[model samples]
Target: MDTLLANITYAGGAVYIFYILTAIWIIAKKNLKLLSIIFPILALLEGLFIDWRWGRIQDYGENAQIVLGALPSFIISIGLPFIGFYIHHFITQNLPKDPMIDSLIEKSKSGAFGNDDYPSIYSLLESKIFEKSSYQKAIQNVENQKELINKMIAVLTDKKDDWDWKFNMFNEYKVVFTLYGTGGSYDPDNGTITLLTNKSGGFMNYKNPANTIIHEITHMGMEYSLVRKYNLPHGLKERLVDTLVYLMFKEDLPDYRIQQMGDPKINDDLKSANDLESLNSIVSKFVNK
Candidate 1:
């Protein structure tokens, strides 16, 4: 029984040590500085507890002749820090933030109808005349929306060489106007951009519909390349998309400056400009090299 107990204690110590080492490795690889400090301490405490339990089991009687069974405990002691670090690192990495839609809301809020250029876009949307029949009017509305979207895409592509390259990658890319749902979404799998015309305060709510269109198309582009290239986390990817929107359309649609400011992921520690510049430098380096 004593031999079995000592083996069990040694095995427990080994498990803790293994976990601690794994955590340390992940933390160091990811450059998680805060976790690096916390994990080691946690591993230490766990190792001590295992040792204490082993000692108690032995102290129960005279058959506890394992007086110098301290080597395993000592080894576990070395691993405690790594365990603590791994826990911290795992928690921070996996903690859920606001949904992807919430990030989109933050990015699109300033441009929504009644906000920036919505009134003008709404007026343009209303200007088109169609047959009085409901079905015919809906069909005409869709056609007019497509014409307008094409015009905007043309302007954007003409202005930026990068836009042409990105937009042309998906040959069958089409924008469909929907009566409900989000401001816009790009489905790379289908090469479609769905624009919400109603439900979220209506399609007219977007201040710069052109900017929204461009932003969504940018997603289609980045979805193919940067996402795969960087292995960017969801939050970071949304921030990068926002940064791209800002960089591409800031001069054309100054209202996008508000959208840039509203990104929840932006912080004093992680400036959007710096992130944008870093990504741009990386892309430029890759292309030039």
Candidate 2:
């Protein structure tokens, strides 16, 4: 029974050592100054406890026997924790932030970036639309929207080649005309894209004909499940990407300035977000509507 008790005591000491080392590694890798201070204190306590228990074991044998039994306990209780903590700290702090996570989240939001990639009449005709026309003027307008969509996709997706993107179109269509403007939804799964031109807000702008088209394209890129959308609010990865999209394209969209629509400090506030809650706060300021 005494042997069993000693073994168990040593094992417990080792485990505590392991935990302390892991914490130390975490602090070092993250350069977390506060944790650095706390870690040594914890390690000291663990060492002290091990020493106290090992001193008690001396009653079982001569000094040499007690020393032999206590050595393993000292190594585990005092050494392992330091090693684990530093290892964890090194790996975690060095891992790169994921860009794809941000892309997925930005794509989920409805905004100008999402609305930037519209197909040109020429390209659509080559792929989906058929026939040439004496209506040269309308064809020219279609080409303009296509350019706008390409630029928007480039800015939002962080890809330079708009023409390289994959696209498919659904044969059916649905549309909505609201007081704010006309809008539509596109379904990528079924290859269907819809348009609702507010008789007043159709693709008429020479400067950004692609805006509506790109917006609908982005909607099509949404993940098929509503559960994903609902759960996204709880995550940080998407928010970071979405934040990147807005920051990259804000110059093209002066009307949607953070200062005009949100607290002037909104961007600054987001710079500190190392996780999803921070990202969410930034997104809410811009896209909660």
Candidate 3:
């Protein structure tokens, strides 16, 4: 009888070790469904095995002693899996949804922008109090500005399907051109792209506005997918956006401009590479697939 009990205890211990190793493997691979199934099995097996082994111990042979000592461990082991499952469920439930993209799709469905209309660009006039007429005058070159806008649209929409869904969401979305210092920005909250007209010495000065416009729009798209959808960290989000932009516009834009879009930490050589394979390898470290 003692030998039979010993064998049972040994087998249980072996199973427990296997469960621990499997749990680690599943966790490392982020196999959440498998983890959900395995953890409960682990708890059940642990409780049974631990109870049987403890039952054979002379100190825990008495019913009162067994209830006092063994019951707590069994309860704890069983409760742990329940707690783990709850945490897993809570995290998955609370994962971020892209509010920006959701709003854009809803706005599109409601016909906020006309069916055939594309995204609009508007010049933000400076407040009368801070009247700077030069900035206002820069945007007045309507014919030249239209030419630049059309060229940018052509470059960005070459493979229309790549961005058609996102662009459709922003049919009414506006790019607010401003003479507010250097660099452009996108506001996910309002679905607006604010381009710094002063960056290349205002609208008339841009040799190619497509470079900057594409960069800012890339940010807008990534914010919807990566930032809002996946809830990626800021550093990883920037890396992915820069890598994608580099891939898309490598032919049209200068190497330096592409490098400027990437994370400053990335080696300049890698960021400026003409090949997509090298660039993708760098981006894959932060984002799988």
Q: Highest TM-score, which number?
A: 3
Q: Which stretches of candidate 1 lie over 4 Å from their true place?
A: 1-168, 199-201, 258-289
lDDT of 3 by residue, 1-289 (tens): 0101111111223353354345434544555676667766765665455445444333321111101010111111222333454455332211112343234334545545332322210111111111234234333432234444444445444543443134322322234444322244455543344444432245422455455555656667556644565566655565656665666556655541433333555444354424333543444453454
For residues 54-149, what per-residue lDDT tens digits would candidate 1 score against the true structure?
A: 443434332211121111222222233344433543321211122432333333443332234334322322332111221233223444344444
C-alpha TM-score for every candidate: 0.37, 0.28, 0.38
1 versus 2: better lDDT goes to? 1
lDDT of each: 0.42, 0.34, 0.40
Off by over 4 Å in 3: 1-129, 140-145, 151-169, 203-207, 259-285
Supply candidate 2's per-residue lDDT for 264.
Answer: 38
Ten contiguous residues with the weakest lDDT in model 3:
63-72
Residue pairs in collision within model 3: none
Instruction: Report the Cα lDDT for residue 131, model 1.
Output: 11
The alpha-carbon deviation from the true structure for residue 30 of candidate 3, after best TM-score superposition, in angstroms, is: 44
